[model samples]
Target: MAKNVNPTRMALSRLKKQLATAVRGHKLLKDKQDELVRRFIELVRKNAALRKEVEEKLTTAFSSFALASATLNESYIEELMTLPSNDMTVEVIEKNIMSVIVPVMNFDYEEDFMAQPFNYGYLNSNIELDDAFDNLATILPLMLELAEVEKTCQLLAEEIEKTRRRVNALEYMTIPELETTIVAIRNKLEENERSNITRLIKVKKMTQ
Candidate 1:
């Protein structure tokens, strides 16, 4: 890299500037990577907890559903499942974390659904079916939250990878190349100065 560069003051100055910029950029990118990792770890932990809770709730709900299905008439249960109990609307918004844009989901649902979720008549449906529907209703928000956190972790991980590459390039390649080129140029310039001084001294002695 140093051999390719012109060993002149102008080249030296340019390389010095580039080295400074690379150093500064490396520092900034390193800081960003650190923060991204921190945020990613935090989201990962939250995602794990949310996933566990959602899975537990889903297991309980499915167990109740399985019991209901076994005890009740198959056609009756199928007909009841076909009916829509409530409506849910999800509004996705962007949130910035260390320059990474992640999704923030806002859920809008019928408030009445939480209060009275079951649509079928009590005479036809058993207690297990009611419990299943109730558990599903309770887990809805948690499921949405889990989705949001998982997505955020993905985005952060991608950003972190990109930042790490940039930091490594500046730290291990660009900055070092520029500094080496600058030193080579300075050494060449000093060598030329000494040769010029020797020539001037010989000329003065000849004139004398």
Candidate 2:
């Protein structure tokens, strides 16, 4: 259906220009959507792999802790848990991916603290407990990386949806409406020109 625009040369010119712009915009947006989807899929795959690794490591860590708990004295375990350990800090920064802003995280820990041995006595602490702590520490960076990737996928997904909507609007609605309106105006102008020619011929015949 044609848009409700005036059937005049000026309106037709304006509509043609609008149609051209809409077509260009649609192509650009479609390209953007494709790239965003590609990046999103890659991130999703990475997220899946990282999640699997993190879960498996966590399971190992938990199993070790459970074994240690079963073999060790509850009071002593409680005392060991109460002791303060190393301090870690996370710094959050933003990065742009296809105009979408996502978070990047950096972790900082004290080098001296990490270099030192466990505070607990060797006789009281079992190997299982040590393994559990080591596993948890090793996966800390992976856990942080997993978080960053998941958030990036989320942001890209949102942008893709928005771009898809715009592309659809231009492809299905705006461009079609302008084309229909321009065709209608051109037909009307031609009809008026034919009528004028006919009237002039009749006037000449009568005068002759």
Candidate 3:
């Protein structure tokens, strides 16, 4: 369907100016969108590598923690083992992603490592293993957060691309079509005026 446009010489001039502005806007948006998409993809790859590292570390830590329990006196440790001292809070602030406003996540973690319940007098064990688990636990949230932001960035990039395409269409297709229509109408109007003037001149000549 044709865009809702009124064909007029003045209107065509206005549209031509608007098209120029639209083209400039499209270029800026496309550049921003391309940069954001590239950054988002790079982040995603890094997140994947970090995630795998975290998973492997946690798996090993958990297994060792399990073994420590199996070999040691479980009952004594159960009563004395308090939870690890770990605290984290994520704050999200505003930033622009391809002109879309989105959250930039900030992570905060307090530092305090808790020792194990009782030192195994003879069967050697690592208390820091517990600390390792707590550390990784804190990092898990951050990894997940990075993943979320990465996905959101991808979505914003797609939206920016879509908007740019619309702007291009208006600049290159719709407005041009309207301008052509306006020109045709204006020329026809001038031709009719010229023909009327000629007819009036002939009538005066005949009467005289």
Number of the top-ranking candidate, with TM-score as the measure: 1
TM values, all candidates? 0.96, 0.92, 0.61
The per-residue C-alpha lDDT of model 2 at residue 121 equals 79
- Which parts of model 3 are misplaced by more than 4 Å? 1-7, 72-87, 114-158, 161-176, 179-208
How many steric overlaps does candidate 3 have?
0
Better of 1 and 2 by TM-score: 1
For each candidate, what is the lDDT?
0.89, 0.87, 0.63
77-110 per-residue lDDT for model 1 (tens digits)? 8887797878889999998888889999998999
lDDT of 1: 0.89
Clashes of each: 0, 0, 0
Query: Model 1: runs farther than 4 Å from truth?
Result: 1-4
What clash pairs does model 1 have?
Answer: none
Give the lowest summed-lDDT range of ten residues in model 3: 113-122
88-207 in candidate 3: lDDT tens per residue?
577878776656676667766554422322333333444544544455555565575766666675676677568667767866886666567666656765777899999999999999
Candidate order, lDDT descending? 1, 2, 3
lDDT of 2 by residue, 81-129 (tens): 6876777889999998889999999988777544442467777788998
Structural RMSD, model 2: 1.9
| Angstrom error at residue 66, model 2 | 0.6
